[model samples]
Target: MPILDPLSFECVSHSDEQTQRLGARFAQAIPPVCVVALQGDLGAGKTHFARGIGMGWGAAQELRSPTFTMLQEHHREPDAGARLYHVDLYRAERAEDVASTGLLELLEDNDGVIVIEWPERAWDQLPPEALRVRFAVTAPSKRNLTFSTQSASAWQTLLKFRKLAFGV
Candidate 1:
């Protein structure tokens, strides 16, 4: 792994809708070949956020949790060849378990975006450029989301997303 200049920002969502909207804004700013690592406990809105990413990315189908299946691929409209890969590593017990899911190949795929939930299951397998989002449930309907990244390009994308979503 390479040393990186980490950058991060935080935002609070008062509701699930707000979290999804924030995710949509981020989706608009993220690069096509990006990798996103989502970290949070169950009911932290990770799947909701990923659904918004799929919406913003023009996916033909809704993004859903792939906990059992482990991976779900959604094709984008207009660009039928473009895809959004949603990965859930919650069930994985080892880094090798994640490796067997073909995540390594997806990381090298430049024509699509990848969003991973429960990335802590395979942190060592993740690329250094991955943008990470940590979620915390603050209330029955509230959530705190922290976005961080070591990659400069992903940092720029997060800045753009923040400006667009928060006007700051």
Candidate 2:
């Protein structure tokens, strides 16, 4: 492990399960109304990571990529009003395409936690406070996940996640 900066840190996942566990640890520390921007190539563990987030967040169903559907909403149990919105902008080519998914409204309303895949497609639309996670494939079953954000609260969240996931 390396020394982690307050605003950024890196974690290496040796398997899909490890990636998902890392994400689950993140979910434990994330705020109720937050945006997570997932950046990486296809099959870079975004969806699997998201699945762990959903599981940790106590979603009623499994979280899956909303590539074709564009968005998928998962309601949390015991508190059905609390929700998680998974958005995929892979098919979007412009900001206008992102607007069609009503993401801006969701962000403004602060209704629930939102996880966006292919966020580069609508960089301008994302909130400045959004936590950004970049993934890189290192081997057939290995990945490097880099988490970063400028927002103070988001950085604190990452710190908490680090303590929970890494015990340091």
Candidate 3:
């Protein structure tokens, strides 16, 4: 069980299609009841990556950063009943402010897949099983994405998933 191993990958993509490809891969990899924390600066493709997750979940509505909306719920294709919650905490002035949004309560209620943007704002709010995805811009449309897991077993599983995905 090497799920906790760290995995890294690089992709050269531009425009929304590139983002969709990355999202497709992630959508296939992620399972139900998974929590993903996306961290990156503005225009760092955090939302782009999340777009993929939403697609994977079969969400039909347009994918956009929930910066202003705070959180948006969408579903994958028809068969997949699991829902995807796109949550953006970019505007929260403080960690305490996050509670006002009721995002925590949402997580507790459904246990569905959650993709959180600006996750650092709620550092103490995430559960121990949450998966952390940190993004760094490598080039204009290129990104360096790293997947890390805090739990020992989770790290091994995630790394294994990455290896199976990248095949390197």
Top TM-score prediction, candidate number: 2
Q: After superposition, how far is residue 46 of candidate 2 from its true place, in Å?
A: 0.5
Query: Residues 1-168, candidate 3, lDDT per residue (tens digit)?
Result: 123344333434455566666666776766677788989888887888888777655787867888887888886566457678889999988766788777889767855888999989998878777778777777777766667767775555465555555664
- State every prediction's TM-score relative to the real structure: 0.92, 0.95, 0.82
Q: What is the lDDT of residue 129 in candidate 1?
A: 80
lDDT of 2 by residue, 17-60 (tens): 98888888889989898999999999999988888899999899
1 or 3: which has the higher TM-score?
A: 1
For candidate 2, the per-residue lDDT at 91 reads 91
lDDT of 1 by residue, 78-133 (tens): 89988789999888888778887777778766457989999988777677788899
Candidate 3 lDDT score relative to the true structure:
0.74
Model 2 worst lDDT window (10 residues): 1-10
Q: Order the candidates by TM-score, highest first — what do you get?
A: 2, 1, 3
Candidate 3 least-lDDT 10 residues: 1-10
Which RMSD does model 2 reach against the true structure? 1.3
RMSD (CA, Å), candidate 3 to true, equals: 3.5
Task: Please give the ranking of all candidate structures by lDDT, highest first, separated by commas.
Answer: 2, 1, 3
